[model samples]
Target: MVQCLSHRVELAFKDAMKKAPLYSKVYSLMDELFKFYHKSAKQSAGLKSSFEALNITPCTPTRVGGTRWLGHTLTALNNIWKGYTAIVKHLSQVSVTTGQSATQPKALYLLKLLRSNDVITFAHFLTDVVAVLAQLSKALQKRETCLYEVHQQLLATISNIKKFQTRPGPELRKVQRPDGSFAGESLTGDTTQHSAQMPKLLTALVETLDRRFSDIDEGVLCATKLADMNAWPASLEDSTNG
Candidate 1:
């Protein structure tokens, strides 16, 4: 039952993100990019070569699919973020490869989409958000986790995600200046509009979490904490009076 609830929350998160245009586009592009290399031996080899050239460890792109759990989604996002430079280089080289003219335009388009400031920002932001969700999901699946523990962890995860409204995650902070300006080589244009969308995205996520978990009996869950011996009153008289 706990594992099921966790999956429901993750699905709610995906639904909420799909409602946002920026996130929708970013995730779609991630899936497309993964498929672009995944379908071809030549492209995959070129990507590995690019990784080697840049001194990045060779790793395959993981697909972001609807059927995947949040942990898999997080892995896919992290893979993309880590291979950002190598992916760009590989795509650039592939776009000019001879005899692969048909793949050239597609590769170039994916490259252009991946390099957009909005895409870069939200991609990193998602990695951070999903990381939190993934951890919660992993915890809830543990055999030792009880109802009260699940409730506590769920609330804690929500609180941590809400903090993103004011303070962006480490991955996001790396590409953003203290003054709220874009600070990376991948970003060149004014991203004020895109940056403004982050809070709204986080709002959607928090609201979804609250709504999805509403069915869980919080009062009952809280009451379960009393079962813990550590939560008992120190004196027998105090316990009797209570």
Candidate 2:
């Protein structure tokens, strides 16, 4: 049952993300960027060199496996966020060094996409959103967790996510300008079209959570809380008096 709930939540998140235009593109880009380096020893070497040149610690991008769930996606996004400069640098070098080869054009295209405001904004937003979902995913997998605790945690997660409608995540806040445009290296300072989409995406996710968990009997789960001694009255007199 625990595993089933976990899978259901992850699938719900995936569905929500895929249906959101901004999120879908950013997610796909993450997978594409990882593969760009994964399939090429030369590009991987270039990425390492870029890291060294920029005095950043070397780390490889993680594969966003189709079946691995949101935790893996979080890791992949973290990798991209941490190594964004290194990736841009590597791609810049590849575009020039590869001359007229097909690799140069592909490298240039990816560089353009990665540096855009929409990708940057939505990618950071997802990093924050998925980080929350990933926490619930981890908690649900614990051996000692009970259905009552799971119920509480699910409610808490939904509440936390709804807050994102007004409060942007730490990562997403970094690139946003006061005027509603986004500012970052190579970004064109255009008003972020993606920021508007965040609320809709979050709403969809909350709805999905509600729909998916609707069948669970909250009253039954509440009753199970009595199994915990901590949930019991401190003394028999208190219980009888109540």
Candidate 3:
């Protein structure tokens, strides 16, 4: 009998930025924005208080660690997303008022970058995509998790992805324009192409997940069948001795 110990099904959606420069740019911009916000949140009492008053949670960006779990990236993206408006407002204020500061130019650059329609779309798309990976990572981290449960989680994630493909969910609307408008339909060129390819990416993810886990899936099914008491005799008859 063979029992598969551990397997990692690489999620295709996680690599959406590999061949696409726009996705990479969006990812980098989000991280850079988070670094600025995190620094401000830590150094400025007034900003922290503002966040609290505005009901925004203060958080920092987390990069992908050396471990198999890549949820930290998702978390970082989420934190930036949760504070998108606050970051924009804060950066704008700083860029306008803090002219003598050495970081003023960078702040102004980031402020303009954040206001772009493509950046907004890509950020929303990334947050949504990473969320799926985060759920799977959390499930796989459980101490008592089994292959059966893992399979179930994989299937659930795939279903969710399909749902998103058919009718892209609420994440797309999460990043509102700095002017308080939606950035849904105005995407153009590369960003539009990337966004339109999401369904294909998700479909590939589902296929890859199923292919990678096929062996473990078989093992899970076999184990489940063997564990079913009603499917087997309670006692085996002795052939030679009895």
Reference-based lDDT, residue 108, model 2: 79
What's the CA error at residue 221 for candidate 2, in Å?
5.0
lDDT of 2 by residue, 175-202 (tens): 7766443333557445356866788789
Q: Candidate 1's C-alpha lDDT? A: 0.77
Per lDDT, what order, best first?
2, 1, 3
- Indicate whether candidate 2 or candidate 3 has the larger lDDT: 2
For every model shown, the clashing-pair count is 0, 0, 0
- The lDDT per prediction is 0.77, 0.79, 0.59
TM-score of each: 0.86, 0.87, 0.68
Per-residue alpha-carbon lDDT of model 3 for 1-242, expressed as tens digits? 11122225334444434544556666667666656655664435545655776687865445543455346666666666666666665666677774438657767777666766666666677678668766776667677775556556777777887787767557876544454444222322234655665556667667766665666556547475454344455556533334
RMSD of 1: 3.3
Report how far residue 123 has shifted in candidate 1, in Å: 0.9
Can you give the lDDT of residue 98 in candidate 1? 90
Q: Residue 122 of model 2: what lDDT? A: 81
